[model samples]
Target: MTRCRYCNRPLRSARSIALGYGPTCRARALAEARAKVIAQHKPTTIERAQELIEDGGIVPLRGNRVWRVVSTDGSTTHKTAGQVHAWTAGLRGRHTCYHRVAAQLVALAA
Candidate 1:
């Protein structure tokens, strides 16, 4: 007798025997797989930007409507417009980065 992979119950049908899972267990396993995929998605850029602010990586330049943001790795610095909330070091041509997002958050809080 073939056994279900999930519940370990005997499989009576030919299709179920080949698939290794009974219909109910197969559906449950698929749903669990989908949920795991959703939960494992990569974190968004905004979260990194938020971390920068929390780490005191953002600073206001004196006598100007500009802010300075440090890179996450501390290898570079970028300037952002205080009012417009745009940064220089962007990923591709998106014209936005964690620095930009951090600037926007600071602007909002002020």
Candidate 2:
């Protein structure tokens, strides 16, 4: 007897047998896949954002006060505005903002 790949139950319906999983299992699988896609589109961290900028993967949007960054994983995540949080570079407690980091990156390249 053919078994459902997901629920591991004996396949009863011809459609379920052909698909290898029951309707409920199929629905669960689809929901999980969608959730994974959504999770992959979450906001990126400052370090990841810097790497994206250096690799030319994204351009910071010009804003009045702060900058914005999107997910580096190539997903359509919403643009996350800069939090003005300072990041330490090898030094404890010492930190700077994205604007300063951008300038530093440019200076390093030039």
Candidate 3:
């Protein structure tokens, strides 16, 4: 017997058999679409960067790097920020930052 694509139950209705998903699944899909439409759009990390300054704070681009910032100065500049964060997280030391300005930025963000 042909099964419902959604619930995997044996399809009883002629329409449910033709279309892959059952009536319940179709309703669920519609509700999900509507919820997405109604939900507020959240900005990504990069996009939210601008708002950081508007609230009267030390902005990332303008603010100095944390005293604890990990060096990427000469050689490591080729690496991405994520790579730098990962590298710093691995090191065992005091004052070593997970990012160029992470220590300072965290204080600023909070």
Please provide, for model 2 over 16-98, each residue's C-alpha lDDT reduced to its tens digit, 9 standing for 90 to 100: 98878798988786677545433443233345445656766434455323334333355543332233423334134244333
* lDDT of candidate model 3 versus the reference: 0.42
lDDT of 2: 0.49
Worst 10 residues of 1 by lDDT: 82-91
lDDT of each: 0.68, 0.49, 0.42
TM-score winner among the candidates?
1
TM-score (C-alpha) between model 3 and the true structure: 0.29
Give candidate 3 misplaced runs (Cα > 4 Å).
37-110
Candidate 2, TM-score vs. the true structure?
0.37
Please list the Cα RMSD from the true structure of every candidate, rounded to 1 decimal place.
Answer: 16.8, 15.6, 15.1
Error of 2 at 66 (Å): 38
lDDT for 103 (candidate 2) = 32
lDDT of 2 at 60: 48
Which regions in candidate 2 have their CA more than 4 angstroms from the true location? 43-110
Per-candidate TM-score against the hidden true structure: 0.48, 0.37, 0.29
Candidate 2 vs candidate 3, TM-score winner: 2
lDDT of 1 by residue, 10-66 (tens): 999988988788989988877776454334333575677678889999898853357
lDDT over C-alpha atoms for residue 10 of model 1: 97
- Judged by lDDT relative to the true structure, which candidate is superior, 1 or 3? 1
